[model samples]
Target: MSQTSFQTPTNKIVLSISQLNQQSRNLLEGALSRIWVEGEISNFVRPSSGHMYLTLKDDQSQIRAAMFRGQNQGLSFTPKNGQLVQVRGKVSLYAPRGDYQLIIDHMEEAGEGALRREFEQLKQRLSEQGLFDPAHKKDLPDIPKHIGVITSPTGAAVRDILSVLKRRFPAAKVTLIPVAVQGDKAKTEIVHALDRADNFNQGQELPIELIILGRGGGSLEDLWAFNEEIVAQAIYRCKIPIVSAVGHEIDFTIADFVADLRAPTPSAAAELVSPDQQELQQRIQDFEQFFVSTIQTQLVQQQQKLTWLQKRLKHPGQRLRDHQQRLDELDSRLHNAIQNALQLKKTQLRASHTNLLRVTPTHRITQLKNQQNNLKHRLLLALQNSNQHAQQHISQLAQRMHAISPLATLARGYAIVSDPDKNIIRTSEQLQVGQLIETQLHQGHVVSEVKRIKKK
Candidate 1:
């Protein structure tokens, strides 16, 4: 080797602290791009920013690990200290501390048994509180007037629900209550939205009568907000009925247990409350067809009845013949009655004429002549008999009169005594002593005073 003096000129370049730190980070990240690590977690901390910081350790070594909020957001289970976990991420250096750490993108419980135990514990707690009781469930509205939705405003779930509602029942009103569908604030926002929908009629004329609380399909952690106790209680307490649609057709949550109904998806929930408009229109058309056919049938029956009645109506010739026959019968009966009456009148007149002739004036005159002759003969005999009878009767009557005469009694020496003023004599018993009396004899009367009493 020959000693030759060759001097090389140095060009110095200086970097800022950030540029130096970035270079170091790139170098360490490239060195451990893909790695699988198993260890127990320690000194675990979750900051308000949603990033996790922890130490991973084995019996002989320990290293730091971190889970950024974005990557860990979809984890089904939470990470805790002293828990064994398996992490899949890249190894990187923190330039500020120059310390090596694992940047975890995925993590799971180290054993399947541990994950199952955690799931059972959560399920047991919820079940013991009667969250899954059918008695606490409500019934779905048969006809929904307004449908309220609680979901992410920009999510596919909202689009699916709107599409189904529009096709099935376009007249129904939809109220969207936009909320976070995942993350820590999801449960709180969902509960508040449910309350608002339930009380929407407070200041309005109409309100949502049925609510759909749902989210699109995701893992258990992404859909955990609906499984929260607060969300389940809100569903139970809602005055308006609720339909729970979380995750997929096979996934269920606490909200599903307490809601009025459970649908397989957001679209299915819409269909539950609404009917197809086209189907209803088809039914109405069928009814109209049936009604028209019935009317035609009745009209046909009425026309047939009218035709039969027309055939039975009487003809003019038959009506005239019937009237003529009746008139002929009446004339014949009238002629016979007139003839009988004439014979009866003639017989009665003959009997009257014979009765008058039997007692005619000529016969009566002959009888009167006979009666006059007999009367003349009887008159002479009657005069002779009357003269003889008169003499005998006069003698008998005079003799009888002489027997009852008062003069005859007087001649027999009988006298009558009476009051002188009245000349009335009844009996001697009526006379009183010293009373004036009059004596009536056959020749004259004498008046004197009673001088003695005589009882005989």
Candidate 2:
């Protein structure tokens, strides 16, 4: 080889392959530490070490990528060849091959990732508008009398809800408001169903007090209808209390946020709204036992009181017999007392008669009778003598009275004059002309009217 003299630059720095790769990696990480890339996954490999190796590509270009065990462990989905995904990682150069690759920290399916972003954006907007406010939530009825179920007619969700309702509370009437749970028409059908249910309750006596909007477990895309703003608005505007049971426990939707209650599953929604018959039966049994026990206790107490009363009570027949014996004794004593009183009275009467006889004065009574006869005879003679003297005095007085009496004057033809009033008139001056006057004779008097008056 011909020797050619060349001047080396003094300030130039040299680097080895490893050092260059290292520096490139550091610069890449510093620049693109956390970038999000979306592409189709190809040549995916998960070795026994649990680290995943894959090629991220698009129709125009492709890039090498890796996810270590620590980073890939938290991935919600498994990575496979030909699956489209979005990854978040830093750009780094591998030292072994000097190949620049993306170190993925997180990965998700591409469709789901877009859906998730949309979901978050809608959630944020609705939240700001107060659609997801707790204050807007309604209270679920304790025991709904009528329930409306909005779901596909043939889906597992309706079957599960109906089965749970029938088992837990058969009395709760179920009205199936069948609707498409997913697809382009799912949102419109659900909103219409909710409106129908709400309107039906308003116009019905047995109204739908509650509604269950539910579907079986599915991917976020399958459950997208529930996340629609129209469905959420319908749920919010519905007068009936709604329970959202849209997917598995981990899944969430806008309808769930706007609903009065969010149940993890369709079966759980049924359970929440209905009361358990078994618990009610148990309580009724407990009440029945308590009532029976109380009645039994009262009966025992009353029976004990009755027994005590029976022990103390005497027979009426025996009481009446004792009273009759006492009456007989009193009757005998009264009879003896009456007989003794009569005998004593008879003895007193006989003694009184004898004493009366002994004290009588018979001879004095005869002497008094003779003395009364002699006094009577003497009194007769004295009365006869008094009568003779009285008769003689009467004759003398009668003769003297006859000589000076007015009757004798009347017998000699002299009369007394009087006025009409029988008043004596001694002078003619006492009479008035044409007045009636009387003249007295021995046997009769005469009445005459004066013809004339003469003054003396």
Predictions in order: lDDT: 0.85, 0.90
lDDT, candidate 2, residue 27? Answer: 96
Cα lDDT of model 2 by residue, 354-414, tens digit? 8887667985687789999999999999999999999999999999989999999999998
Quick one: best lDDT, which candidate?
2
Best by TM-score: 2
TM-score (all chains, Cα) for each model: 0.42, 0.44
Q: Candidate 1: RMSD over Cα atoms?
A: 34.3
Task: Please list the residue runs of candidate 1 whose C-alpha ends up more than 4 Å from where it truly belongs after superposition.
Answer: 1-119, 289-456
| Weakest 10 consecutive residues of candidate 2 by summed lDDT | 1-10
